[model samples]
Target chain A: MNTFVLLQVSEQVAAKSADMAAKDPHGIIITAVSVSVVFIALIILYFAYTFIGKLTSGQIKMPKIKLPSFKKKTAEVHPTPEEMAAIALALESKRSGEVYAAIGLALHQHMNEKVHDNESYVITIKRRN
Target chain B: MNTIIESLQQFWQYTGFANMTYQHLIMVLIGIAFITVAIKKDWEPLLLVPIGFGMIIGNIPITEGLNVGIYEEGSVLNILYQGVHQGWYPPLIFLGIGAMTDFSALISQPRLMLIGAAAQIGIFGAYALALQLGFNPAEAGAIGIIGGADGPTAIFLSSKLAPHLMGAIAVSAYSYMALVPVIQRPIMLLLTTRKERLIRMKPPRVVSQKEKIIFPVVGFILTAMIVPSGMALLGMLFFGNLLKESGVTKRLAETARGPLIDVVTILIGVTVGCSTQADVFLTGSSVKIFGLGLMSFIIATMCGVLFVKFMNLFCKPENKINPLIGNAGVSAVPDAARVSQNAGREFDKSNHLLMHAMAPNVAGVIGSAVAAGILLSFLG
Candidate 1:
């Protein structure tokens, strides 16, 4: 009885092995085909891009555009020495006025105790009762 | 008094305490562990935090017929999960990846693209292993993509080829991606000599803005012509690249890379996590998938490193590549590239490999997608 059971089990095992062997060829074929395809695709890309790299190596320079010149022709002007002196005197007086104005503003703020805060810029009027 | 007691007993029966089992407890504990590791180790916090919390939310036992679970039809989670189920989220994610990625590295040095191709050997290797383990060809193909170390690609491929295994495959791919530093460092060190690690290649040339713009257009045509099955993923990716490189669609590019990707990522991560209810995820097959995933990752790293050493044999001394950067050829984005930089720095502090590694890193993304398309053609 034991021998008979062992024989049956061995036969089943062999059958399973045969079935697996039948499928192995498919696996082998797919593996070979897939690996080859991957290599071929990437190799083609490699060569293609290598060529591209060489072609673009020098950098594709964009054409330089020349803008139309907009030069304005005008005669040169020179001021007389007297006019220059008058201009300098006017500039000096203007600067002194600005300095005085700034000082006056500072003094007014200090006197009103408004140095630390900004003015609200609102005018208030008391209405008659 | 008897009626009140009856009502209390009925209420107790509907509680989570009554419905819970050891499996639920175990799954909850696993969820807690995921959360703790993500917070404590600062590993893949963006992915792990949402996935971890989703795991907790998924495993909470509830009364049957409530239609509240991710697996149940008409549930909110199931609706969100349709993105993963139908494989739309991955293409959208690829769109974002393309918008964010700077292909100057790959364009500057096209030779590195070969390393990406060689690393894909791991996918085939894992497929064969999965077949030996008795999974059907379609299932094995889905499982094998974990070698790509790209979570979206894995999810995309698995959803089409073997929707049953999508959850395990996504989790395994992401887990390995998160452990890139730990898993890759040792292998990278073991595979190369100190001299090879210290060897530095010439800096990549400057890529023109015109070339950058033309790349997506030409790239889309070439790749799509070769593998029309990959049109959805490849098209979206190249389109996103065009938006970024065109300099004319700044708003669209910003949305593609920023808010759009973030929303898709959250949905993908949480839904994938929720799909891992204990009865579904804690299976013998899940364990086998994890084991296969690790082997696939290790094989990819080995192939990448060894291929670089092979490439170095024919190159001039000045142009010889550093073998350390080879590990970046597995498409884990900046993480794998960062690993190469860190490993190279250990040998010679002056040598910087991050910029160089990114060439193969991005190439790996393209290579994996191509491989995925091939598998889909064969299996799907």
Candidate 2:
């Protein structure tokens, strides 16, 4: 009897679905059902996440995984006094070269009058002259 | 001389000028206008430029039986268009979206998800309206998804339920998405009082990386269990999110969000635009779809704002939500969220609502996909 009743209910649902499929869909019912289903689904997500949020209110303790360092280790070598002096001279020469190049470019532009004057492009007439 | 004359006539017949119709000219002009707006106005240029160019390509008059048009089975355009028609591009697009999205805001404030669900009233509202206007249920469902403010979701649902209307629905969905700021701002302002706009709730709590990683996996299981039909879109979305959040798959996540999404976007945008051949797109139904789409967008914005106000009634004064951010409940992504920030700044410069608005904005993506799934289950 229980089996029969379950079968009957299943049949009724199938019939109802078929009926809905055959007819022009009842918009009100579709809207209500779709809205309800979407709400129910999202609401479930909301509650689940909310619960999770509460449970995990404190900081999560994740196991630290140590990654291999990619940096290469070089042996520390002390430069002799003469070597250090040579290195310093080379650095000074490079810095002076940059400065000289900039100065030369600026001087060249100035000498050639390549830089624009900041004068306003206004015309004045002198009638008396 | 007679043979030469016949050959000349054949050549003339094959030329575009000989076969040009007013419809083709009109569509071409529309394409040019799209390109102009995208360039001059700088609105959704990524989407509009490709689509506009594709529209011109689609509308160029061609002789029959040449297998050159998008509709021709063996044509290259048609082959590319299969992605759109077969409903695969949307899921791929969703994967990219998932990879790019930061669900921290939504995770921090789960209650805000309701606003996303409420905003979906526009989908059902449009569904009813479309039915009243004589569209069948499946077509109505497809048209209604435009309210979701999600181009890919609309395309996915329409491709499944109403293939014939996919082009019109896609164009309408994208057009309305581009117009979100224009449409949503006025409605947002109209619905909320000045005080409501100025309401500043507490900042969202910081979501831990564990929570972030857990969210996609759990979110997928729960949503999919409830609406298995939405598995295609929802699964891709969550999988993409998982790839991003897992920390172990940085390269994979980067690829999904970057190059993969870009390529899919170009293909989807241009092919969707190409699908709008003048013969298929120019119709009374297309006009009605546009009208319904606008109405749906307005309704969705209104519902989002109103629902926030409703939620505000139960909350304490300090917890009250600013209705301005509610407009972000439609899933237009950072654009809708940006509108909230801009509108809120108009009231209070310090009240930055962009982060808060993103909660509902991302939730709307899930809600719309679920809504699409429901429609598909019922109508597919």
lDDT of 2 by residue, B161-266 (tens): 7777888898889888888889999999999998898899799999989999999999999999999999999999999999999997887899999999999999
Superposed Cα deviation of residue B221, candidate 2 (Å): 0.3
For model 1, report DockQ.
0.19
lDDT of 1 by residue, B21-137 (tens): 898888788778878888999888888877877888888887767777787777888788889887899999999999999999999999999999989999989999998898877
How does residue B263 of candidate 2 score in lDDT?
96
Task: Tell me which residue pairs clash in candidate 1.
Answer: none
Backbone clash count, each prediction separately? 0, 0
Candidate 1, B254: how far from true, in Å?
0.8
TM-score, predicted candidate 2 vs. hidden true structure: 0.82
Candidate DockQ values, in order, are: 0.19, 0.19
Best by lDDT: 2
